[model samples]
Target: MRCDNGPELISAALGEWCEVQVIVLHWIQLGKPTQNAYVERFNGSFRRKVLNAYLFATLRQVRHLLTE
Candidate 1:
């Protein structure tokens, strides 16, 4: 999985879990979001469609809208 260089993601616990599972956690370099354009694009789309389009009152309401 490709991720930004976030502190929580770089934690020892997550590192150990990834190691045990042989999961390659590819990190994007700092200030280099262009390297992860596809994910960034999807995030923008989701935010525009689901987030900006509504005023969600609760988690269940958000889930119901998405499921519909």
Candidate 2:
């Protein structure tokens, strides 16, 4: 998996899990968003379309909206 140096992705648990799963993680250079352009674009779209469009009262509501 290719990822950035975000704190969540840099956690020991995630690293151990990836190692056990035999998945190699490639970290892009810091401040280089172009390396992960597709995912970045998707994240921006998702934030705008779903996240910013609604206020959820519960997790189930979010899941339901996603399922639709």
Candidate 3:
């Protein structure tokens, strides 16, 4: 249940059911948005491109996809 200021990733029901701790990363304190540029790019790429394009049927598949 971790996100980067996105409501879509803030799934309360899923978090509660899985008992996961949510963590968010912000770049303001880093002086500039580019300070955490890699994470910023990863978030958009993961959310928009990869996540939308992939559909996993099981937790093992999901885990394998992520781990690899």
Candidate 4:
């Protein structure tokens, strides 16, 4: 199981489906841009797909999107 610690919904469910190892990367450690390629790309994707779509109406909206 590999995921960004950002999503608690997914992080909270780690190791729940069969036997697996969870690797959560730190933000600074991840900034190196080489520890992981695909995961880093996906991180950019979520930021674009989910974050770019919404026109934030208030601070709460930005907070809400980050949580999801």
Best by TM-score: 2
lDDT of 4 by residue, 1-68 (tens): 33443455344355453234445434424345555568779878988887677788799988887788
Off by over 4 Å in 2: none
Reference-based lDDT, each prediction:
0.89, 0.94, 0.60, 0.59
**Model 4: residue 67 alpha-carbon error in angstroms:** 5.1
- Worst window of 10 by summed lDDT in candidate 3: 22-31
Encode model 2's per-residue lDDT on 1-68: one tens digit a residue: 99989887899998999999999999999999899999889989999999999999999999999999
If the candidates were sorted by their TM-score against the true structure, best first, what order would they fall in? Answer: 2, 1, 3, 4
Report the lDDT tens digits of candidate 1 across residue range 1-68.
88878676788888888989999999999999899999889989999988999998899999999899
On lDDT, the leading prediction is: 2
Q: Evaluate residue 44 in candidate 2 and report its C-alpha lDDT on the 0 to 100 scale.
A: 91
* Reference-based lDDT, residue 65, model 1: 93
Residue pairs in candidate 1 whose N, alpha carbon or C atoms collide under 3 angstroms: none
Ordering by lDDT: 2, 1, 3, 4
Q: For candidate 3, lDDT tens digit of each residue in 1-68?
A: 22343455456675565555453333244335465567778877898876788887888887798888
Which RMSD does model 2 reach against the true structure? 1.3
lDDT minimum window of 10 residues, candidate 4: 17-26
For every model shown, what is its TM-score relative to the native structure?
A: 0.67, 0.85, 0.41, 0.34
